[model samples]
Target: MRTVFVQIGEIMTRTPVLVAGAGLSGLSTAVFLGMHGTPALVVERHESTSTHPKARGQQTHTMEALRLVGLEDAFVAASPKSRGFALRIAASASGPVFHEILHDTFVPMGHLSPAASADASQEAAERLLLGRARELGADVRFSTELVSFEQDSDGVTAVLRDLRTGEESTVEAEYLVGADGHRSPVRTALGIGTHGSGSIAHNVLWGIRADLGHVVGEEQVLYYLQNPELSGGTGVLVSTDDADRFVVGVGFDPDTQHLDDFTPERAVEQIRIATGVPDLEVEILDRAPVETGMYVADRFSSGRAHLVGDAAHTMPPQGGMGGNTAILDGFYLAWKLAAVLRGEAGPGLLDSHDAERRPVGEWIATNQYRNAMVRTGARYDGPPPVEDPATLFFGYRHNGAVVSEPGDEHELLEDPNAPTGRPGSRAPHVVLDSPDGPLSTIELFGREFVVLTGSEEWERAAKSVAADLGVRLTAHRIGDGLTGPWAEPYGVSDDGAVLVRPDRFIAWRSPGPGPATDLERALRSVLAR
Candidate 1:
C-alpha cells in the first residue's frame, strides 16, 4: 500500500474551499473547484479507498457529471454496463415471479461526431478525467478527521485530527462544504434537521462475488420468489467488469423470517432458492447487513456552509439514486462556490445550491419510496402498468428553482425513450468533432459556462456574452454531418442554440432568431451578475 502524508503543525493556511470527506461527492467537488483555480482541501477519515461498494449504480446523468470533471471513463470502467432493471416479486405462496425487464442501450460516439469511435473510447475518457483532476492540484488528505469548525465573516476555521499520529491542527477556508455521509458532523453542528420518514424496514444486503455460470446470461436479472413461510423478496444479478465475478444483492427484512433468516447463510440460501437451481454453486466472497433509510435534509445550505451527497439527502437502495444524486449535488454546488471564490459571482449564488438540489432530492426520495412500495407490494394503486423499464431511468424532469418553465405535468420518462438533454436538465452525452479529435459533449463541459450554439447567429451572441461576463466559454456550431437524433430529442433544431451552465444544465436556449438577452441574465442569476 502507498501513502501520502501531510506534516502536522505545518499550519496550512486558508484555502478558498474546505471540503470534509473525500468520497465521491467530496472528491468530485474538489476536482471541480481545482479546475477553476480555486484552492480546495479535502479531508477524509478513512486512510484509503473504501472497499464497501454500497452504491454501484451510476445513471446517465452521473456519467455526464463525471465527464465534466474528466473521469467519465474511470467511472464507466468501475460500473457494469447495465441495460435496465429487472424486477422479481415474491408472493406469499407459490414460486417467484419475474415481473419486469427493462432494456436500455448506451449511445456510441459516431452519432455525435465521425471522430468519436466506440473502441476504447469510454476507457480513454475516464482516464483523461481522473488525470485532469490530479493535474489540477487538489489537496486531498486521507486518514484525517474533521473534529470541528468555526465560521466568521472573513472565513471558516476547521479543526482536523490526524488519525495516524494523534495530532490536531486547525485550517482556515473561505467556505466549508460537507460531503460526508448520512451521519454528517457538519449537519449536526449546524443544527440542520433531516425531514422524512425512517427506513420502511431494516434489510441486510448480502453481496457475493461468484461465478453463477452462464445460465443467468450476461444481462442483469432480478428474481422475486414466493414462499409460504417467508413472504416475497427480490434478488439482483449484476455483471461486473470481471467476467468471472458477478455481484449479487439479496434484500431480507430481519423482522420477518423471510426465506431462512437475515443471516449470511440465510442470504445465500435465499439466492439459491430464488434462482430455483439448487445444483448451481456460488462462491460467497463478502457480505454485510445494510440499514436502509430515506430522508432529506431540511436545507442544503446555511450561511457559507453547504451540504452535498448523503449529507443533503439519503434514500433507500431500491431506487439506486443515492450515489447518482450525490454526484449531481457536487456538480451543482462546485461552480457556484468557484464563482464566489473567484470574485466573479456574489455570495447569494450559493443559495441556489439548496434551491436547485432540494427538489431533486425530494423527487428521489419519493421515487425510491415508490420503488420500495412496488417491491414490497405495499401500494399497488398508481398509474397503469407499463412494460418499459427504461422509463424509470430518464423520465425525471428538473422542476426546481433552476427550471423556470417545467412545461406540462408528466410522469417520469421510461428508459431508452427518455430525452437526451433539456433545459435545466442534465446535458446528454454526445460525441462531437474537436480540433484535436473526437470529443464527448461532457468532455467540453465544466470549469466554466459553455454556450453550445447550433447556429452562427447564436455563436456570435455566445462570444459577446462570454466576453461581457469575463468568463471562459466554448462556443460551437452544429455542422451538417454532426446532427443526430439525440439533438432533436433535446428540442433543439438545426438553427437553435443552448447555453450550458458550468454545472452542465441548460441555463438558456434560443431558436436562433437571435441570442436571448435573458441568457446572460440567467447566467448572472446562477453565477454572479
Candidate 2:
C-alpha cells in the first residue's frame, strides 16, 4: 500500500502505472498493460528508441509472450535467415577452430508451441512495441526522465522532468515500475541492494559494419577470437540483423589498459586481426565500455514500486537470457498490476511478483555468471553444466496463495516435455482444432481468466462462479471452439476443469466433479479477495 500526495498549482497527470526507463522491460510493461486495457505512462530520458542493437536473441518463451500480442510473425520476419548453426572458438574468423562449442541440427518446435524462437535486434523489437503501445493508448514520452518518487499507503507520487526543456511536472500513479537498466537510479533511491558476482570483467563493445558473408559463410556463428595481438588475448564476433553489420566484444584489463587505449586506428587494426583479414574495410557504428557481471536485487518490489529487467537482475552475456528475462519480468508484473488496479484483486496479490520472479532472476543470473566464467576460460572450482533450452524457457513453477493445491517440496524448474498441468505450473500447450482452423491452447489466454473443460457442468459452474465473483472469466468447452484431448495432459479427468490465469499459467485444476463452491473458492484465493 502506497499513499499519494500533491501540491497546489502543480501540474499532475494521473495514470494507473508510471514506468521509468524506455528499454525493453519498460516498453514491454507498457505494451502488456495496454493489452490488458491498462494504459501506462512511460518516461525515457533518451530522445527515442535504442539505436544500438543491444540484445539479439529472443528465446522461445519470449516469442510466446510476443505471440500473445500477435507480434511473433513480425519479429521472425525481421530476423536474419541463417543457413546453418555454429558456435566455435578460433584464433580469428578465417583461422583454424580451436574448439567447437555447439554444432547441432536445429529443429523447429511447431508441435510444442505456436511460436518459435528467433533472433531480432532490440531496436527493431522496440520499434514494433512502441507502435503497439501507442495504438493501445499508452502515453510514451521521450526525452523525459523520472526525477524522483515517493510512496506511502495509497499510491505513488513522482516528479518527471523533460530533459530537452528542463521543465518538471508531477505524475500520480497507482504503481511505479523501474526498468531503467543496470545502473538504475530508481533502485538506488529505493535502497535496494543487489547480490551476486558483482563484476566478472570489463570489455569494450564495438558495433561495426562489415561484409563478412564470404568470410564467415551463411551460418549463424559466434566466433570467440583467441588472437594474441588483441587485448586480453580474446574477443567475440557475431553477425547482426543487417547482412553487412556485425558486433565485436574485446576484453580488457582496467588495471593496465583503459578506454583511451582503444583508439580508432587501434580498433581498425584489432578488427582486421580478429577477422584474419589484413585489408578488410570496416565502419565503426558505435563503441562503449561494458562491465560484464552477475547481479540480482535482494527484492523485486518495495511497497507500490517494482523493478523489472536489468533493474531487477543483471548477468553476463553468455546465456542470451538477459533481454528475454526482462521481457518476462514485464509480462509477469503487468498482469498482476492490472488485476489489482482494476479492482479484480486485492493488494496482497502484488506480493506475488517478488516471490515468483526474484527466484527466477537469481537462478538465471547465477547460471549465466558460471557460463561466462567457463566461456572466458576463467578458473572455477565448480563444474558448469549446460541447461536444456526448453527447461530454461518453459519450466517455471510457482507457489503460494494464488495457486490452489501447491504441494510441498516445490521445484523451481520442471521438465517441459513431461507436461504437468499442476497448480502453479505453466499450462501445457495443446493443439486444438476450431472452425477457424487448428490453434494451440496457448491462444486462448492473455486477456482474462479462462476455464478449459469438456463437461457442460464444469462450464456452467465456471459461469456461476464468474457471476458470483464479478470477475472477467471465460469458459470454453473442449469440444466447442477447441477440439482435442486435453484432460490427461491437463492432469484432469474428462469432467474436470482447469483454471488458467491471463498469463496462461495454471491457477487451479479440479480432478473430477467437485463442489459448487470449488471454483469460487479458488478464484477468491487466487485474487486475494
Candidate 3:
C-alpha cells in the first residue's frame, strides 16, 4: 500500500529541531532539547507506545542520565531496584548449578537494594521521563512517518506523512536528529552504511507471571541452559521487577525452526528443562522473538543530521548497553547542541560528540558480543574482558577530548579490594549529609559541570573559571566524615577533587590541589572555547 501523508501546515517560524522516531532515544533527545528551551518535533510511525518492552532493563549509567533530565525519582518509582544479576549453569548429572553473581555495587542504586525495588525504579523512571517530556511541550507526533528530507545551508526540510489522516507536511529545522531504530530510514536516506555482523542466532523472549519462589531461590536470577549442540543454552529465570513473574529468553536457529516452533508450550518446556524445574508453573504474559546482531554506523553525523542510539550502533543485548548508550548519547549531544545554539561554543564542539561517543559504542559493542558469545557457548571470541582497571564502569575514556592528559596511560585498577578515586575511572559513589538528610554523590550529578573539591579555595577557583568561561559550575566540598560511601570507591580522601561532566563521566580528577589549567583546557576543548 502507498504510505499515507500528513501535512503540517505553515512552516513554524522557530527552526524546530526535527526528530524522526519516538522510541526511547527519540523521546529522550526531544525531552532534553525541549527542556533546554529548544523547540523539537518528534515523529513516530508507531500508533502508540510499544507494547513489547523491547528494552526491559536500564544500566546504572542510564539511570544517571535519566537523573540528569530530572526523571530519576520518577524512574525509581516506576521500576524495581535491580541489585544483582545471577547466572545459572545447567548441568547434566546435577541438573543445574548457580554460577556467578555480579553484585550491583557499581554506583547510584548500588547493591543494597532488592530486585523488586530495582524494577520499580525502572518503571518509575520511564513514566517520569515520558510525563516530563509532555510537560515540557515536546511535539511528540505519533503515527507519523518521515518520508524524506532535503538539506541546505539554512536548514533541513523534511516531509512527514500522517498515517491516520493520509496527509503530508514539511518541517524545517536547523538540526535533524535521527533517533530512529536500527533500521533507521533517515540513515538509509543519508546513505549511511553500518559496519558489523547480523544476528548470529535468533532468540525468543517471553514474560511470565508465576509464583516461582520455590524454583528460584534468589530475587534476581539468570539461567544459562545447556543445549545438545554445546552452543549457548536457553536463558530462563525471574526478573528484577515482578517477584512472581519471570522472563525466559531462548536461542534457536531461525533457519531451521519456524515461528510456530516457539509456541508457549515449547517455550515452557524449554524453561523447565533449562532451569531443571519440571513442576514450575508460569503464566505467560507476552512473548517476542528477536534476532541478535551487532553493528556500528560508518559515521554518526552528516551536516545537520546526526544519529543516536540504535541508529548509531546496534549491539547484542547481552550487556544491556543499548538503552544506556542511547541515553548517554542524548546527554552528550544535548550540551553540545546547547553550546552551539547559545553561542557559548563553536561547531567544533559537535565533532567531539561523534569522536567521543563512537569509541564508547565500539567498547559496548565489543562487550556485548563477548556477553553474547558467553551466552551462546561460542568461542568467546570478542575483545578480552576489559582489564579490571577498565571494567565497563570505569575503564571508558574520553581519549584526547576535554580532560584527557597527553601521554596518560590507562592502567588496570580493577581492585574490588582497592580504594576508590583510582585514575581513569568513574569517581566512586559517595554519600554525604544533605540538608534533607543523606544524599549520594551521584545525586550531585546532572545539569552542568560539577567540581567536587575539599577546599574552599578550590571551590572558589572552580567558580571563577566557570564565570570566566560563561559556564555553569557547581562546587561541592568533601568534608571529613562527609565522604560516606563514596570514599572507598572513588579513592578520594578529604583532599582530592573531581570534575564531572554534564554526562556524569569524570572529566578531570586529582588527588589534591593542582593547576587549574588542565580543567580549563578540558572545558575549553569540550565547549570549544
Candidate 4:
C-alpha cells in the first residue's frame, strides 16, 4: 500500500523502486529489477560511473547471478586473461620469487560453479551494468544524491538533490534500496547500527600503468611483494586490462602513518620497490583512498526501505569478496522485490532477504578476518584455514517461510563439491534437454515458481494448484523424452515433486505423491496468499 504525498517546496516524482547509489550493488539491483519489468530510478552522487578498479575478483557465484540476467558472457569478456598460473610473492620486486601465494592449477573455478569466474575490474562491470539497466528501462540519474527520505506503512518519500545544479526534488516509491557503499547514509538515516571488527585498516588504491614483465617474467593476476622501503612495506599488485596496466593497493593506519604520505610520485616509487626495479617508468591512471573494515548492519530493512551491498555489510579486501557479496545481496533482494511488486507474492516475501543474506554476510566477514590474519602472518590459535573459493561462494542456506526447514548446521551447507538437491539449498544445476534446446534447471527459474516432477499426477496437481492460486507457477514434468530419473539426489521418488522459488532455491519438496489438500496448503503457506 502506498499513499502519495507532495510537499509544497519539493517537485514530486514516482517510481516503483528507488535505488540510492550507482555502485555495482545498486546498478545490478536496478538492472535485475528492470529485467523483471519493474522500472527503478537509480541515483548516484558521482557525476558518472566509477573508474576505480577495486574488488576485481568476480566469483562464479557472482557470475551465476549475472548469468541469470544475461550479463555473464559480457562480464567474463572484459576480464583479464591470465598469462600464467602462479601468483608470486617475493621479499622484494627484483629478488628471486620466494613462494607462489596462489596458483593457476586451483583456478579452474567454472567446474565448481554454475557459470565461471572472472577478473573484470569493478569499473568495467559497472559500465556494462549501467548500459544493461538503461536498456531495460531504468531511469538512472548520475550527479543526483538522495539527501533524505521518510517512510510510512504505504511507501517511501525521498528527497533527491542534484549535485551539479543544486536542485532538490521529491520522489515517492513503493520500495527504496540503499546500496550506497560502506558509509551508507541511508542506513544511518534509518537509524540502523552496525557491529563487527569495525576498523580493519585503510588503504590508498593506485591504478597504474607500468612495465613489469621483466620482474614477473610472465603475466599474473596477483603479486604480494614485500619491500621495507615502501609505504606500508607490502602491497598487492592486481592485474588490469593490459599486461602493463595494474592496480597497487597499500594499506596504512590513519592514526600513525597518514594516507597523505602516499602521493602520485611516491606511489610510483613504491611500485618500483615492489617490482624490485630501481627506476621503473609508471603512469598513474586513477587514485582513491578507501577506508577498509568489517561490519554488518543490525537490520537489513526498516519499513519499505532496505539495504544491500556495503550498506548492509562491510568487510576487508582479503578475499576480494566485498563487491562479489554485494552483487549477491542485490540478486537476492531484486527477485523478491520484483515478485512483490508484480503482485505475485506478498510483502512477507521481503523478509527472506534478511533471514537469508544477513547470515551469509556475517559468515563472509568472519572469513575475511581470517584472510587478514594470513596477511599479517599471525599464527591462528588452532591452525590456519584455507580459503575455499567455491565453498565460500555457494555453501550457504536460509530456513524460513520460503524454504523447508533445514536439517542441521552441517546439512544446511551441503558439500559444495557435490551439492545435492537439499531443502533450503540452491537448487542443483541439472542440464535437461528441452524442445528449444538444452536448458539448465537454473534457466527454468527466476521468472516464476517452478515444479520439477516426473509423475504425471504430480504435474496435474501442480497445475491445478497454480491455476487456483493465480501464481506464476510452471510445472516441468520429468521423462518427457528429454530427461531421465534424476530423483535420487533430490531425495524424491518418481511421483514426488520439488518446488523451487524464483531465485532457484528449493522452497518445498514432497517425497511421494501427496493429497491435493496437502500440496495446496504447502503452496498457500509459501505464497502467503
Summarize candidate 3's per-residue lDDT along 1-529 as a digit string, tens digits.
0111334366332355788877777778877776666657788898865554445555555656665566756665555444455555554212545444244423343532111112332233434555677777777778999889988867788888989998877776777899888888889989999887666667777777766666554446555555562214555344646677666666766778776877677777766655556766767788777777888888888887889989999998665567667766776787667657766677677777677777778778867777767754667555654423225644465543355545556433344334344333455555577666877776776667788877676777788888888887888876644445443465454566778866665777666676777667767876766
Per lDDT, the best of the predicted structures is 2
> How good is model 2 by TM-score?
0.95
TM-score of each: 0.75, 0.95, 0.77, 0.92
Q: Which candidate do you rate higher for TM-score, 1 or 4?
A: 4
lDDT of 1 by residue, 1-529 (tens): 0122345568555677889887767776777776677657788898754555455556555665555555655555555554433444643112345354334333332332222111112223223333455677777778999999989777788999999998888787889999888899999999999987667655444455655544455544444333433323444444444445545555566665453455566656665664555655766776655556778999999887999988888787665666666666777787788777766777877777777778768777767766766765555576433323244434455433243445634223323344545566656657666556666676656657776656777777778877888867778666733443335655677677767777656666664456447667766765645
Give the clashing pairs for model 4. 85-104, 93-275, 93-276, 94-276
**Candidate 1, which ten residues in sequence have the lowest lDDT sum?**
113-122
What is candidate 2's lDDT per residue for 19-106, written digit by digit as tens? 9988899999998998888889899999999887777767777888888777889888877787756777888888888888766424
Query: lDDT for model 2, on a 0 to 1 scale?
Result: 0.84
**Lowest-sum lDDT 10-residue window in model 4:** 1-10
User: RMSD to the native, candidate 2?
Assistant: 2.5
Number of clashing pairs per prediction, in order: 13, 7, 47, 4
Question: Candidate 4, residue 256: CA error in Å?
Answer: 2.7
Report the C-alpha lDDT of model 4 over 1-529, residue by residue, as the tens digit: 2333445655787888999999989998998888787888899999888777776767777887888778889987887666644566665646666666676623665444457777777889899899999999889999999999999978888999989989899899999999998999999999999999788656677878888877665655566656567566666676766778778776667788766687667887777776667788988887777776789999998889899999999887776788888887877788789878877678887876777778878888878877766664435664454477767776777565554545544343556567667667777766767787766666667667888888898888888988887777888888875585467766789789888877777888888898766677776777665
- Judged by whole-model lDDT over C-alpha atoms, candidate 1 comes out at 0.62
